[model samples]
Structure formats: C-alpha cells, structure tokens
Target: MKLVVRVKLLPTPVQAAALEATLHACNQAATWAAGVAFEENARRPLELRKHAYAEVRVRWGLGAQAAQHAIKKSCDAYTTLKANLRNGRYGRPGTKRHARASGKPVVFRPEAAQPYDDRMLSWQHQARTVSIWTTAGRLKGVRFTGQAEQVEVLAAHRQGESDLVCQGGKWFLIATCEIPEGDLNTHPDGFLGVDLGIVNIAATSDGARHCGRRINRKREQDRKLRSKLQKKNTKSAKRRAKKYAGKEARRAKDINHKISKRIVAEAERTGRGIALETLTGIRERARLRKPQRTTLHSWPFAQLGSFIAYKAKRAGVPVVYVDPAYTSQECSKCHHIARGNRPAQAVFSCRVCGFVEHADHNASHNIAHRGWYVWVCGAQSTAPGLTLIA
Candidate 1:
C-alpha cells in the first residue's frame, strides 16, 4: 500500500515564478490533451504517449515525465467519464444522468498541478534540499521544511512519483511512499470488533467506548460560528470562517489520532485482528432526515477508520471490514434481521431470543462474528484470510 505525506517547500522568488509558469504550461497542455482524448475516445494513457512525451515536452517546457503526467491527467479524465457512462453514473451527455447535466461536451479544466517522477525530483540528505525540474529548463533546489517527523521521512525512505503544487504563494510537495501491509495474525481466542457511530464515535465488542459528545458539541459551535460569519458575506469574515474551518478539522483529526492509537494498542496488546463494517455508499443510503443527514454528511467516520487502519498496520494488528448491510438491525445473538430488533437508538433487543444489549455494542459483536466466520470458513481459512474483514 502507498500513503502520501505532504511537505511544504520554500522556493526562492525566481524559482517560484518558474515553477508557477511551468505549472500553467503543463495544465494548459493537459487540458488540450484531455479534450482531444474525449473527442477521439483515446482512453489509454499510452494512446497519446508518443505525441505527449515527444511533442508536449518541447512545447510546454516540461520534463519527460512531467509532460507524460499531463497526458495522464487528460486520459484519466476521459477514463472517468467513460466509467461513469458505462456504470450509469452519468448517462450520455444528452440524458439527465450526470450530476452536472449540462448536456454539453465534457471540457477538461486541468488544474495547475504537475506530477514528478523520481527522476525529475531528487532529495539531498546532506543539504536538506530537494531538487525539481522547472519550465526554465533548470534543476532547482527547494527546501522541504516543517514537521520534523515528516521531514525525517522525506529525508529517508522516499518513493514513487510526487506532485509539485503552487498555492497561496507557497509550493508543496505531495510525496508518496509504500507502506507495509498488515500480515493478518488473529489471536488464538478471536478477533475484536469495533462499531462506529455518531453518538458514541466508536464502540468495541469488548465493551469499551469512545464518546463523541465533546467533539459533536465543538463541531456544532463551529458550524454556528461559520454560518453567522457567512451571513456577514465580507472578505475578512469569509477568511475567518475558512480559518476556523481548518482549525475545527484539525481538532477533530487530533482526537481521531488519539482514538485510533488506543484502539490499535488494544488490538496489539490482545494479539487479535480488528473487525469493522464496510460502510460503502453510506452517504447516499443513510436515509436520515434533513438535520440528521447534515450531521451524517459532516461526520468523520471515514477519517477515523483510516486512522485506525494505518495505525493497526504499523502495529501489525490486522484490520478488516465486513458487510455492513444489517449489522445494526440484525440481532447479534440470534442473527435475526428486523426493524423490531432495535426499537430505540441505544438499545438492541431481540424479540425472538429476548437477547438485549447496547445497540452499537451488539452491532460490534455481530461484526466481529461475521469477520470470524469469513476468516475461519473461507478458502484460505487462516490468519491472513481475514485481512479484508478481520
């Protein structure tokens, strides 16, 4: 698996100008290439590889791979459109399938971004400066600073292609590196299951809980503040709102980091795999009322899941996601699926078996049981078999 780490770059005035110009050139060419691909149905990246790698490099003053990245940008867009069309995500342009149903040709508006292969971007450990290719046809050195830990990682174990971006008078490097996948090693006893929710944040089958009360209150306060500021409609007010929005996200992320750490630690200590629900399409299918929908839309369930996953991987604690279709509604004990199983928000009582427990906690047990079945009965039927649903 690959994960990205963003590092801020400090470029000199002249270098910054060159990088900006290069970004613009690359994006313009990408946009043009995208239009050509869409019109001609050139889906593969290599379809235009010859012309893009040969001609666009000279025309746009881009490095070899940088120009290729632009071609990738265009072809990727065409590919996405094609997928949407085939999957009925977006029907033909004339139909009312696409979310943006202008019925016009999909024009590619390539962002002012350039991708850099390892050849185009190099790091000097001694000087603590990174070298990148620019439109000026010169190799420029940009300092990568901030976050000591991130800098250390950039200085060591850097891998794969990276993106050089210019925004708000600053340059940033989105560096990518491979991470070791977790080798599933379930405990002799069983795996642990965790259920994620809005009210509790996360509930474990082991009966531990991480409450979301404080975070929800803080988020509501920030939301009210932002709404009030947006009503003012002034530049400063908007800026302040945006600033606080970032702060609030950071606050939430910090809390998620802590929660993930604790959860992974528990799994590590127990030598058990962790089970989670595959909540795909949750946003579209939650079926909540207007206010509830808003809360659900803004919830940080996905972020927390990712945090748990990455931390689990590093700790060698296998993590997996099981089918989430009825984890909540189904009775954890008897496996009976019904609306009557859960008559209240926090309670889960089985009408048939008369088994009762905390809703989320019971859900966690069911998730853990499903994961255990999948792991023990599947063809592979071992520790590693549970990686996808531990």
Candidate 2:
C-alpha cells in the first residue's frame, strides 16, 4: 500500500525566496507549455516535450530535469481537465461552463505545487533536513518536521516523487511511502456495520455513536464568519477569509481520521469485517430542505468511508459495501420495512414488531446482516476462490 507523508519545512528567508521564485518560474513555463499543448492538441508528456521542452528550458532558464517536469505538469493538467469534462463535471458540452473550460488554455498558479524526483530532491532523515533544486541554485539544509511515525516511514519506505507546496505561506513537502500490507483475514467471524449520518457522524452496530453536534456547530460558526467577511468585501476581510479558507475542511479531516482509526482498530480487535453503505450517488438521491442542504452537502461521508477503507486495508481487516436503500426505515429486529418506522431523525419504531431503537443504530444492524449475507453468497458461488476484500 502507498501513503503520503506531509512534513512541514522550516526554510530560511533566503531559501523561501528562492523557492517562491522557482515556483513562479516553473508555473509560468508550465502555463506556456499548456497553451502550446492546447494549440497543438498534444496530450502526452512525450508529445508535449517535443513541442515545448527546449523552449521551456531556454525561456524559463530551467535545467533539463526541471523543464521536463514543467512540461509533464502541463500535460497532466490537460489530462485531468479531459477527465473532468468527460465525466460532465463542468456541465454538458453546450453549457457555458463546459464551453468556457474547453475553449481556454489551462493556467497554473504562481505558487502551484511542483513535483521533485530523486535527482531534484534528497532528504537526510537523521538531520531532518532536505536539499532540493531551485532556480537560484541547489538549496541545501532546509529543515523539516513531521510526526515520529511519518518520519520513520519516510526513512524506511519513502519512494518516488515529492511535491513542494506553499499553503497559507507555509511550506510543506508531501513524500510518498510504500508500506507493506498485513496478512488478510479471510475468515471473519462477523461484520461490524457502520452507518454514516449528518446528525451523528457514524453509528456502529456495536452501539457506538460518534456524534457530530460539536463539529457541526463549529462548522456553522466558520461558515457564518466567512459569509460576513465576504459581505464586507474589504481587502482585510478578503485576507481574513483566505486565512480561514480550509479551516473547516482541516477540522473535518482530523475528525474523520480519528473516527476511522478507532473504527478500524475495533474491527481488527473483534476479528470482524467492516461493512459500509454504497453511497455512490447519495448527493443526487438525497432530498433536503433549504436550511439543511448546506449541512448535507458539506458532510464528508465519502471521505470517512475512504479513511475507513485504507485503515482497514493496512490492518488486514475485510471491508464490504452493502446497498443502503431503506436501511433506516427497515426494522433490524423483525425485518419490517415501512416509511413510518422512523418517527424522527434519531428515533426508530417498528410499526409491525413494536421494536424501538436509535435510527442510525438500527440501520447499522441491518447493514451488518446484509454484509454477512453478501459474503456468504459470494463465498458459496461457483467461483469459491473469490475473496471479499484483499
């Protein structure tokens, strides 16, 4: 399995200036290359290099490797744009958004992240320092810091390229590391069902509820602050808004990480597989009132699921996705399905069996049962060698 370890860099003022200059030059070169690719209809890195490589080196005063990376970056941007367009992310072909995106050449920001291969960047794990190539020259002894586990991973299993990013005026290098997977648990005793919701972030079949009230309150405050700042429309207000741009996202990500870690650990300790709902088109399917739409859209349910998956993978715990249709309204005890079963957001009462339980918890139990059935069916199929999770 591959993971990214992001470490903060503490560079001197001079070093920072050099890095800023290097980023600006590289991005300018990349933007020019993208324009060339757009005009020439070149999508591949090799093809773009043929048209722009030499010019990029000479025009931007970039070295051979830096020029190649710049060209590759441009090609990668085009590839991403193509994928987004193909998936209808920008809208239909005749729509304004789609036409605007398809008609214009891609542009790179001045401080956009740049990739550094082994030749362009090297690290000293013991010293917690890095030496990297720059437009000014080769800059060395730039200090960095990260968690102990991340540092250890970087020292032992770091591989491939690192990206140099400038966010909120702070420098960070995201290094890739290859970690070996644990042995798979093929014979799981049962499945630990987890139900994700807006009120309670997650509810497990084991009767654990990770509440979202505090986090949601904080998010609402941040949203209100941002709205006020935007309404002010002053330069200082804009700066403040920029400072808080990703604050809510960072908080949500941290919460998701902690929740996923706990969920995975519990599943591994109990020798059970993790079962989650297949929420692929949840946003499209969900209908919400005006007041609740923001909360529904802002919830990071997909991110939480992904975190659980990767953590489970690292722990060799099996994970299965089950259909989420009518899980909440269905009774976990008597298997009675009715629209009136859920009386409130948090209450579930079975009209047929007189069963009462927390809505999310009942749903999780149903998910667990479905997951077990799915696993059994798959195992007994003609292809008995098929594994649920690997």
lDDT of 1 by residue, 142-210 (tens): 777767766665556568777777655668888776556666554525778889888898999899988
**How do all models score by TM-score?**
0.82, 0.96
lDDT of 2 by residue, 54-148 (tens): 99999889999999999999999988999999999999999999999999999999999999999999999899999999999999999999889
lDDT of 1 at 277: 76
Candidate achieving the largest lDDT: 2
Q: What local lDDT does model 2 show for residue 48?
A: 93
Give the lowest summed-lDDT range of ten residues in model 1: 381-390
What are the per-model C-alpha RMSD values against the true structure?
A: 4.4, 3.8
Global lDDT for candidate 1? 0.74
Once model 1 is optimally superposed onto the true structure by TM-score, how far is the C-alpha of residue 133 displaced, in angstroms? 1.2
lDDT of each: 0.74, 0.89
